[model samples]
Target: MKVHEIRELLNAKLYVGEGLLDKEIIGAYASDLMSDVLASNYLDEKAVLVSGLNNVQLIRTAEMLDLSVIVLVRGKTPHPEVVEMARENGIALMTTTLNMYNSCGILYAQGVKGFSNERAD
Candidate 1:
């Protein structure tokens, strides 16, 4: 799906990178634990990170992992520094009022995949 498709499904607000709506989202990742995010084998070149952690580091993590979009679950807005970094790094940012679990559920229902609870060996 595309970024606009996600926005349409979630009724989310694009905090930054509004022009990035054309980007392809192959899957979604919902985790507050950045470690787990780092461990996942991401087949999706574009991932909509659904997390409650709103900070500049999250943006860095996203960049390091080559994630395309950051979806702030539970209405958690990123700080100005985070926004600046996201802009500088060309990362798209969005926020939704829905909690993490529900947001993940909705995205899953909409066909976002590539998550497994099992840990990497």
Candidate 2:
């Protein structure tokens, strides 16, 4: 579903990249460590990285990885710089008070799939 579709479907609060509300998202990942995410090699263009840490680095990493959205878990809000970074990269940003697990569950229930094609090395 598109980011705006996600917002409407998930009732998410958009903090940045409002212009990209219609951008589609194919999958989601719940993580706190940016390094782990990088290592995972997300493998989806419209992937949403749901994390708890709200900082500039998160935005930088999201941009670097060409992610579609960053969902802040545990209600953590990103700084203005982070928002601007998302805007610059056209990556949508949002947050939810729901814990990571709950958020992931909700997204899944709403038809957002988790990382597929994952295999043990």
Candidate 3:
């Protein structure tokens, strides 16, 4: 999936990196725990991170993991500095009203695979 496709799928508000809409999203990782996010194996691939934690460190984690987009679930919005940091790092940021679980489910149903260890099947 592409960044713009995710935005339309989740009815998300694009807060940064409008220019990054063309970026390919090869996977998705949904987690509020920064530690878990940092530990995920999906970092090797281009992915969209779905998290409820709307902090600057979340952006930092995304950067460290080489993620292309951060999806803030449950309508959570990041601070201005978080947005700025994302823009500087070339990461796209978006938000949705759905909670973490719902967000993950929707994305999963849309052919977005989860991290290797996160797969239930």
Candidate 4:
């Protein structure tokens, strides 16, 4: 699915990266824990990060992961700096009225698969 499609499906408000709406999303990662995101080997540039946590740290995490899209759940509004940072990093940031669980479910039903972390040990 594309970023714009997800935006429309979730009734999300786009805050940044209007030009990036054409980016393709191959998978999704939903988590409030930054550590979990950092540790996940399943993430790639094609994956979208979904979370309820709204902060600069979330933007930083997405940057570090080289993620192009982030969807903030539960209608949480990110701070000005957070939005600015996402804009600066060329990331597509959006917010949805749906909570994290429903957001994931909707995406899943739309054929958006979650990033699977299969332990090698």
Best of the two (2, 4) by lDDT: 4
The worst-scoring run of ten residues by lDDT in candidate 4 lies at 112-121
Using TM-score, give the best candidate's number. 4
Model 2 regions lying over 4 Å from their true place: 116-121
- The sequence of per-residue lDDT tens digits that candidate 4 reaches over residues 3-119 is 999999999999998998999999999999999999987798999999988899999999998998999999998899999999999999999999999999999999999987763
RMSD of each: 2.5, 2.3, 2.3, 1.8
Better of 2 and 4 by TM-score: 4
Ranking by TM-score: 4, 3, 1, 2
Residue 50 displacement in candidate 1 (angstroms): 1.1
List of clashing residue pairs for candidate 1: none
Compared with the true structure, model 1 gives a TM-score of 0.89
lDDT of 4 at 41: 72
Cα lDDT for residue 12, model 2?
Answer: 70
lDDT score at residue 9, model 3, on the 0-100 scale: 88
Question: For all candidates, what are the clash counts?
Answer: 0, 1, 0, 0
TM-score of each: 0.89, 0.87, 0.91, 0.96
Candidate 1 residue-wise lDDT, 17-74, digit = tens = 8889999887788888888888777424477888898988788788888887888888
- State the displacement of the C-alpha of residue 87, model 4, in Å, after optimal TM-score superposition: 0.6
